[model samples]
Target: MFKTHFHSFAIALLLALPVAVSAQDQKPEAPYNAQLIVRQPEIGQGSPSFVPSPQVRGMKALSDGKVYLVSTDNKQLLAYQGNRLAWKADVVGSCPTVVGPRKISKVLLGPKTILVTVGERTFAEVDTATGKVKVADGQKG
Candidate 1:
């Protein structure tokens, strides 16, 4: 009876090992940054070529866990984690209807912050964790 109980206890400990290990192995999700535009560098005829497009947006997901929705080319940015919307915010306010073309000129990333520049005058500061939007007015970006 003693040997039988010892073997059973060993088997029970082994069965619970994975659960304990997995709990300790869990890590907090890190904020991810993705570009609305894709830039490819290629060698053409022994020369370097760098190309960028405004309308073409791409997604590279290992699985369908995270999905990003970009509104009006690159004006607004949204991110969905799993089946829920992780965060949503207007990246660059509504561009003029008749002014220069609407485009994201520069994207700056800092600790827990994301800033997007539109044209030469508009700047948007977005919270990376919660997707909060803060438009900088009369500020040079």
Candidate 2:
């Protein structure tokens, strides 16, 4: 009787050992799928120079490493090389119409051109090399 009971207990222990080992070896679920991208801020010598313009509404970086910023106050645009302001130009023509408190909404940088949109109505295509406003089109809000 004693030997029979000992053999039955041994079989039960062996079966339970495998289950406990596997339960301990199981892995937890992985973290959620998300990626983070980091961009380094460019710093130059002397004080952190900001482009000498009124307000910068939007910005785009070109393939040639030039940065363009749009100024909404005077309906103008400015360019930056490193930390210095390279050039500035008026976007409006001889007959200036009110752009009506517009804010630059989007910017797309191309190989040779940059496109910027203001609010929902106005947009401009600029030459990345020359910092010239190639075209500015708008409609009433």
Best by lDDT: 2
Q: Which runs of model 1 end up more than 4 angstroms from their true locations?
A: 1-72, 82-84, 94-100
Candidate 2 off by > 4 Å: 1-62, 72-74, 92-100, 139-141
Tens-digit lDDT track of model 2 for 1-141: 999999999999999999999999986532211111111133432321122233433333424555555554645666666556677766543112435445555555566766665555576777867878787777676
Residue pairs with backbone atoms closer than 3 Å in model 2 (clashes): none
Residue 3 in model 2: shift from native, Å? 99
- TM-score for model 1? 0.42
* Ten residues in sequence with the least summed lDDT for candidate 1: 43-52
User: Model 1 over residues 1-141: C-alpha lDDT tens digits?
Assistant: 999999999999999999999999986543433455332222232311111244434222222334444554666666567445687776556433212336555554444555656656666676656778755543432
Per-model TM against the reference: 0.42, 0.45
lDDT of predicted model 1: 0.53
C-alpha lDDT of residue 84 in model 1: 59
User: Can you list the residue pairs that collide in candidate 1?
Assistant: none
